[model samples]
Target: MTRQSRAHLTDRGAPTSRPVSGPADHPVPATARFRTFRVAAFALIVLVIGGAAIGLVVTRLLGPGATDVAAIQVHASMGGFDPPALTVKAGQPVKIEFASMDSSMHTDGGGWHQFAIDALGINWKVGPLASEVFEFTAPATAGSYSWYCDICCGGKANPQMQGTLTVTG
Candidate 1:
């Protein structure tokens, strides 16, 4: 090609004075951009405050160490309930927290344990390595009920896995 032809070919792709940058290249005035930034900052502040309020509400409603009522802790494992028994007054509302210690991967309900009783209508099944809290009202009749871990470790037949919930007047 001739020298003039080469020069024309190179000049065809040269850049112009118009910037190729983002939003800055848009011809909006400084005041308009500042207003957009102010709006975004205000929205962020509102979101943060709203999130903090929600968190505080949730913490107050479900946080541990409830002091208003009688509470008891019951732990479960491959062996049995920690105390192997529990006692409560008839018709009294009680909080029972069940904590599962071991993860039973080889059993039917893997890593899960249960405290079930048909008489008092209580059946609490907890996931492996986790804990759960529930409320219960003792039977008004006042008698002994069989509670057992009928999951993973063994059924009610296993003496070690069974316990008695004795309700008294």
Candidate 2:
């Protein structure tokens, strides 16, 4: 065979001038580039909205400022709670501050008072001569809800230990 024919048929360990074609070699279409840009922009927008929503949720769960009313105070003594009845708006956020006005020497329940309302999932406690503050949403439906101090002040038997929560529409 001729020298030229042998070179064409077999490799001589030398570089070739011909270029290999692949994805990198070809230019991307304008439509494909735009589609990728659109997807990226959409993802960014979704991320921003999601982050904002999460931030709002965290802030609300963390502070009592989310409630419309400043805290309403209630004092617990051996006789009963001051302001035997409370009025609130239905479906509204409320903040309550319950305080124990008696010393630990009280005989009812050792001066440890509890504020509980089973229907609204409220159960709070306060030490003798101390106070506690908490927040909760009023029931959706307007109605009367009963509250009591089961500890330091008798459970539910004492008329003085009972209080009524009036939720209005």
Candidate 3:
């Protein structure tokens, strides 16, 4: 109620307080803040650009054109073909890579196994630890074709080394 007390009171009769500054309250220069933001933005841009470059390179390497050639890898062991079944689109070009994995002792001199599909006219002798690539177009008709090892594992009636190729439209 005194003049000195009234000087510390606000219009609503509450005490007035002054603002206090701490170490965290220090103002940063506009250029310094902008430089930090710019560096972060540049790093983000570089990351985006690098990701796009990698995607482009991968697309060029494994695009549809590269996949136009159907690459199939079949391993032959004592059991049979590894996959035992293969599927391809009708009239599509297919590249089959056959590997003979049979390690049994051979006295007939026929190597380990022989891949043959009498219907498709695909017959290739694959030796142990060796691989062969056969390129052919799938049959125009969509049907099931059988393949088997003729030499080492007998014929289609034998279930051990027989497989089926399915052609889809």
Give the candidate number with the greatest TM-score.
Answer: 2
Q: Is candidate 1 or candidate 2 better by TM-score?
A: 2
Question: Once superposed on the true structure, which residue ranges of model 2 sit more than 4 Å away at CA?
Answer: 1-69
Best by lDDT: 2
Candidate 3 lDDT by residue in tens digits, 1-169:
5533433333334334634334333232335667999999999999999999998667433322222234688777666787899999999998987777643354433446767888889887777556678789999999998888866655556797798899999
The list of candidate 3 runs beyond 4 A from truth reads 1-70, 104-111
Q: How close is candidate 1 to the true structure, as a TM-score?
A: 0.56
**Runs off by more than 4 Å, candidate 1:** 1-70, 104-108
Q: Is candidate 1 or candidate 3 better by TM-score?
A: 1
lDDT of 3: 0.70
Clashes of 1: 0
TM-score against native, each model: 0.56, 0.57, 0.54
* Model 3 clash number: 0
lDDT of 2 by residue, 1-169 (tens): 5544544443333247644345353333435667999999999999999999998667433322312246898877777877789999999998888877676676768777777898888998888766677889999898998899877544777788889999999
The TM-score ranking, best first, is: 2, 1, 3
